[model samples]
Target: MSSIRAVLFDLDDTLWPIVPVIQRAEKLLYAWLKLHAAPVTERVTIESMRERRQQLMASDPVYQRDLRILRRTVLLEAFADAGLDTRLVDEAMEVFSKARNEVTPFADVLPALENLRSRVMLGSVSNGVADLDAIGIAHYFQASVAAHRIGCAKPDAAIFHAACDALGVAPAETLYVGDDPLLDVEGAQKAGLRAAWINRVEIGQDRVLPSHVTPDAVFGNLHQLEQWLKDNDPLTR
Candidate 1:
């Protein structure tokens, strides 16, 4: 182990439970859509909208690779198909984005991040289109990398390497913290960085470890992550 000059984090499930947050945001967006476009409301339910979005993405080869673009494209197509004005799509997306940002992180996130901030350079590497500024955590990161912007998503060594390059640190000296075992841990390891899994679900109990991507450490939450940082001599190589 060496002193951690930088720390990279994963967004979505790693920072907070994204599914519920997005669900709530979509609900809010749908409510707004109902008010603004009555005819569209008559034709599509939220569930159906989601299904159509999936179908549209499945039919498009490029969208199958980039989820962020797929999301935007899906929203546009859904609005068109529902006979809604296309101009409102951007407004609706903006509303949903703001609502998505109002998510409550796990109790441990802020305090742990506050503690680690002074100790190391922190940044985020996400596979989706999360704007850290929208989430009000932008100040905490020195850099934020998204897969859509980077042209490469996680599980790809290039993306991890790009993050490391942006940080001006070698991968061997950076520690990446993420929730997914394969995408976060294994991917980081393959890129030559130490990886820690934030296993909030307690699902590791019945799972056999995958051969290619073992995590250097695992934590139940940010509290455990802080403890790991303090206990380990990060400076010892």
Candidate 2:
């Protein structure tokens, strides 16, 4: 209910739809594999590669904690499995990483962000290994705290606290906006900050509200979010 001095965002699904972009990136990676790595190309299909990556990731708790390392680990294993050079994993990962950066944000994002930037300090707190600079949105944030850099992931209070620390603001004075109900909303609230749910998908689930975690406000998309910011009640509250 106080004036929000800063706003923290969740990357991936919050900023842009992650599923489609990842699918496209993987498709591209597989095409490259088929063309360049003949041994790997013959041994594994794209679906199998994805399955292997998931299985390998599940076996390692550390990999689950940091998505960047997880991605590199998966790529390395895939290369190793195909009897190809492991050293090429890094180069392949670079290509995939660039593909990841080529995301298109929701239509309302730029204008909303442009408007919000002048009013409050903007920063990011992500559980993944996305480099905002690679995505060309680095200038929009004052700080970006990722799990790999901080050595902890959300809904751990330490990670949330670190983001607030980086912004030089107390938890209560900040607003955390994210897509995941548990990880973003509940986690931020537990860390003593107000939270907002960017529920872009109308999944018809009321599970995130007033139960597991109660967000201060909820919006269906960035357009609604922009309108809310213009009204100022959500941010002021």
Candidate 3:
């Protein structure tokens, strides 16, 4: 086995439950719109706005890669459609971005990170706009690479390579841990890093793995992962 010298983590579903974060942020953004951009609230419901975002994501490749731009574009279009001043776009984005960064990390996340960091270099690579500083976990990571900043999303090897490079480690000596089988696992594997699937949620068997993509390790939580590394790889222990 390649001795693991560093570990790169996926921020969203791996470190925290992202569904609730996005849902709460959407509600907060809509509430802000209702107050300041009343005309926008009149024209579009929250569900409609979600549909619009999906449509915009489908319409362009950049939208799929950069969530902040996608959301700002949506707000601009909404304000323009309602004849509201576009200056409010920044304010509205602030409301959503702040809420989006208010994520609650999983219970096991900190402990695992503390244990793992002692044994190896730690960093993060995310496709989302999660701010590590805002989330209060910035100190744990030696590097944090986001797709928006790099102009490429996961499932593309560039983002993974960027994270490895930032950590001063070759991909062969690093392990990538994340929740998504295709985007995180397959992407890291293709980028030449060992990959571990962190299945925090209960996934049905049918939804587990793509036929051609198998993770080097799979665990239900980060604590389990730490234990697995200790049991399977003496170097990590």
Candidate 4:
């Protein structure tokens, strides 16, 4: 409403669905482990590996912010237990990272990005370790902030502030677009930026926000968000 000069996004679910991508990556990583570190595979399954990651993060919350470290640590520990060369952790991560970055954006994503970038500066702030450059959308954003790199995650405000600083805009003049109600909408609002919830499906179906959390706007697709921008900001219109 204050004439948005910049827009920051949450990468994983905002631009593209992440669950399937991670699932596929995990499958590939597990296959790779089975081939190279056979002993580790004998003791570990993909589901159990995921559980170990969860347990590790539960023990030391810092791993929740540093996903890469959490993943590598899990692999390293598995390698150690199996008496396999721990150096294979690097190769294992490379395999997973490559598979993880292969993302297909939502149908409305590219068209809306092309339209929005012409109107305002675009940046991304994500808690996940998604490689935007590898995903081939790096050129669309002026800045990309990852929680692991910034040492803070969303809902903390520092990650959002980092993105705004990188974009050379004040939080009040930026709109943060994301899919999560609490992590993205409430988090952005708490960080002093306007929040727009991008719910591709029917609302209150899969998830609902707390009674106290209210987003500035909500849309089903990026096209609607682009139109909202043009309607709200006359300069862009």
Clashes of each: 2, 1, 0, 0
lDDT of the structure predicted as candidate 2: 0.80
The TM-score-based order of candidates, best leading, equals 4, 3, 2, 1
> lDDT per prediction?
0.80, 0.80, 0.90, 0.90
Lowest-sum lDDT 10-residue window in model 3 = 200-209
Clashing pairs in 1: 1-236, 1-237
Clashing pairs in 4: none
lDDT of 4 by residue, 1-237 (tens): 478999899988789988889999999999998888899999888989899999998999689888999999999999999998999999999999999999999899999999889999999998899998899999999999998997888888999999999999999999999988988999999999999988867322255667988999888889999989888888666
Indicate the TM-score of model 1.
0.88
TM-score of 4: 0.96
lDDT of 2 by residue, 1-237 (tens): 666888899988788878888889888887877777767777777787778668866797676677777777767776788778898887778778888778888777778778778778899999877778877788988889998887888999999899889889999888899988989999999999998998776433344455767788898766676566658655433
- Tens-digit lDDT track for model 1 on 1-237? 566788899988887888888899889988988888766777778898788778976786556446656766767776788777788888878888788788777777888788888887788888877778877898988888888787778889998888888889989889999988888898899899999988776423234457766688888788787777777845421
Every model's TM-score: 0.88, 0.89, 0.96, 0.96
Whole-model alpha-carbon lDDT for candidate 4:
0.90
lDDT of 1 at 132: 84
Instruction: Report the C-alpha displacement of residue 81, candidate 4, in angstroms.
Output: 0.6
> Model 3: residues >4 Å from true position, as ranges?
202-207
Provide C-alpha RMSD values for all models, in order: 2.7, 2.6, 1.6, 1.6
Worst lDDT window (10 residues) for model 1? 201-210
